[model samples]
Target: MLEISPAIKNLEKEDIADNLLHYVYNTKHLLSLIKKGIDLDDPSYLSSYRSFEGEVYENFIYEKLLRYAEENDYITKFVLKGFHQGKCKAYANTLSISEKEQIVYRTKSREISEFDAMFLTKNNELYFVEMTLVKSVLKLRRRLRKKKALLEIIFPNYTIKSLIILNEGATGAKQFPSYCKVWFTKEFSAAEVLEYITKLDKQKLLPKDKINSKKMIEAHMLKLHPFRYYNTMSWITKTIRANKKYVIDMNFLMTEKVQRYHDLYNKFYVGFLTVKEMKNILHLKEGEYSEEQRVVVALEKKHSDEIVVTYYIQTTRKNLYLYSFNDAKVVKEKKDPYGITVTEVFHINKLMNESYLLSISQVNTIKKLLKERFKRESQKPNEK
Candidate 1:
């Protein structure tokens, strides 16, 4: 027999509800109503209930229990079904004997019933669970017996177990049903139920291990589809296009593999030139060659040659003059003549679709010079 003291009955309900509410809110409330002495079994009380209409009570309980098991670290991946109070059956047998002739007859019977919760743990073990804040010990025992019988028939492969969470103090030392255990609690706290659930999970009572493996395998297989690749590429393209601050450098074009493929394709594959290569490809050199003096007057012009600036000069005195972009004409005339002077240059080249060159490495210095000359022709107003 399972009985709870009057004082502890509501506490049991509250604890269960609190634990469940951590995962399912509305169910917690309904359990709260139950704890508050609202008769859930009463039809009138159910009629006024809102939240999720059409099967609200069943849905609420189902979702709450599902979330409860999940949150408490119990296996929740198993299939779920709701049983109405009078829709299931308990197994029973009756026998009749004939008095005169030694004839005997027997009959098997069943009655419809419902259970509060059912769980299948990782080990494929089935648990028939029943909960009540009801003070009737005999009634609780009867309910547990009935649920146990049905579970045995339905889940024969599983080791059926029953758990009765009650608020009543211990029901003396009476033998409970064959496959039943009861947990008595004094108050409603989600933590306690979660702890109990965790213990149960650790015992390998839930079918979590098998379910997780199956789910993982299925997910991995899905990733092998071509659609996944296509979607990944599309995502990369969209992300690159969205970021306007950065440039895409495909320097892998210089690798041996890329070069080999490009050669095999015979110019059909340009092999992904980098921003630097693109800049070099579009560079134009501009310098004045004096045929009679056998000297070249070289300078980087700005704004389509609208602004002339001499960066280097070879004079008749065998001297070289180096001038920076911001230097005055007098400063240019004062510098020593042939010392291989270096200056930073900024230019936009149209060859790679009008991209700007900020700084060039020593490897791309010639390209930088060519771009400086091209900038002189089509420099934009924003270049300065």
Candidate 2:
């Protein structure tokens, strides 16, 4: 008798099992086949075994998602409804909590489509995930749109969310549906992906007036490993104390030292800012700043506070822009010993600059600083 996991029993009929078998067969003689004239590394071979590779990749993603749904606290809120490889029939049998079907079929279009994985929460939100190893999203766009339409028709009441997980970074990512979130496995780990999917976006931050200095400082001091505000401040202060001859404004010194530390250690200085500071950085008059203000205001309104606005300054030659993100969904908000409300972690959902305002030259003197930093970084010796 063959044993199947209760969680994945419903998926046994899907192509994941077939994909695994194919993967094993392909991998078994892969080395010998490579030595014998078949160059698996060649792009030409993609058509032959790429399906197996893709299926295996999809299975890997499904497993990771399954693990998260079982183990992670944040992911626990979501229940893995089912996994379907290509096509499946709509089942009347409903999960204990919700009466919704995991898969849907349309008789008019006569199309049987399904996402690689699907999840649901008690609140009637549906998450559909697709995994691909392809480098471009062009071919996948039509299928995604079709699947979106199918799901919308079946689950009209639920808020449907789509996630596309790519084996690596791809081109034409912008071409995907605006509502869809794309993640590159090469850029993000399974844990990071889980954190993103289950992040808390509905939690509103305390209003700016209600926010205290301690809360503000805590937001700014949000760590990015190896570097934090206090650590940078201490280093700059000690260096200044030792060298009384070097004179610089405290604000200027902090900026210079932060950049210096980043260049030296290849670590980014991750910090948070308020909407007011962001507007002040642009330093535009009412009419002039209106466009940027809209982006900032919309983001601030989503989180209901500027405490969620996070930015990281990277001084490395490769990283050019001052990347920032808003809509940082917090895990939990609680009062600390000081009676100040604080968030444990700010899991960023989207990089604002990619789709919004941070790239503008006038914002934070980006254009001037980009040139200066690039020139300075170019002059340095290769990092050890």
Candidate 3:
């Protein structure tokens, strides 16, 4: 007897089953046969094996599981690789919780196990699942318990439930122990699974005290990891701490660092510096600074000249300020004529320094000012 979901009737009316089967037999079969070196062109060869076609049939079954779960209101997410050990695998999986942390768990060291699926309810209760195409109820129950133990270790805070779904006639559903639930073809429908999960009242599942404790732990973990504020924020923190004994001004340090970076970054400049040298010049402590940020700054310089030309750029809610030396007053000021007018060019560099001089045009302007100053002084004596 063919065991099918009542929802399968809905799918049948639309000829979705025929289309799905067609997809299954053609692309799925051809790919599987090609792997085994079976003669696909021979009609007799195709006729002899009219039923199962190995992994291809397994893939089609997984797809059907996904379609059934989605149609029945389970929100599904899949992890094809990196999330588990062994060869890469696909999971037609579902999660029911809204917790900020990962509810599903898998370890790479467990060689025999390919993947583990988890469904968490809003109340902090969870179901740990291990699926097998094998029809044996005994084998399924054993594997399901193993998965539950693994998840208990991974998610210590949440209560764990266990479930196993196996092929029909593999074992009687009664074989499963009372503590665990076994779903056979006739007893459990995709709709029932979806309804059971969706109807779970999260408020009842998650106690306020547990949620609060989880939140506190999460907050402390975030502080340790510390979200990347600026690209160089980590470097800044480490460098500042390493030299904490010295009275260092952040603004002054940033200005000098940004200017030095600009000089090294601009390849056309006379004092071209390598990334290693730039790191040392910035007074960076060990691996505090990332080469990634420096590479990005270098690439920006490669594409445009504007980034290398600016200095001491700062932004407020309303406006931006560029600091440069005014030879006329012999002092640095908040505004300079050569400063960038457009706000979009704003960027942070770790090498902008006092010793850094402007480009050739800026140099000429200062020399011209000095010449005029000398001329004014000479005329004053003549007038006297």
Give lDDT tens digits, candidate 1, residues 239-318.
32233453322233234443332222111110112333322222312323232211111223232222232333333343
Off by over 4 Å in 1: 1-64, 72-111, 168-174, 187-384
Best by TM-score: 2
Q: What local distance difference test score does each model get?
A: 0.35, 0.39, 0.34
On residues 1-384, what C-alpha lDDT tens digit does candidate 3 reach at each position?
A: 113465432222232232222221233453355457878566744543333332223333334433443343332222221111123232112211112122232212112123333343445554544444444456555455445543443355766675455455665567565545554432222332223333546223221111111111111111111112222332443343234333222233335443333232221111112234434333335764344322111111222112221222233422433322333322223443333221222333333232222334443443354345445645664431
Q: Which portions of model 2 show Cα errors greater than 4 Å?
A: 1-37, 41-44, 72-111, 187-384
Estimate candidate 1's RMSD in Å: 32.6
User: What tens digits encode model 2's per-residue C-alpha lDDT throughout 218-262?
Assistant: 111211122232234334433422333322222342364343432
> Which of the two, 2 or 3, has more lDDT?
2
Clashing pairs in 2: none
Ranking by lDDT: 2, 1, 3
Residue-level lDDT for 188 in candidate 1: 37
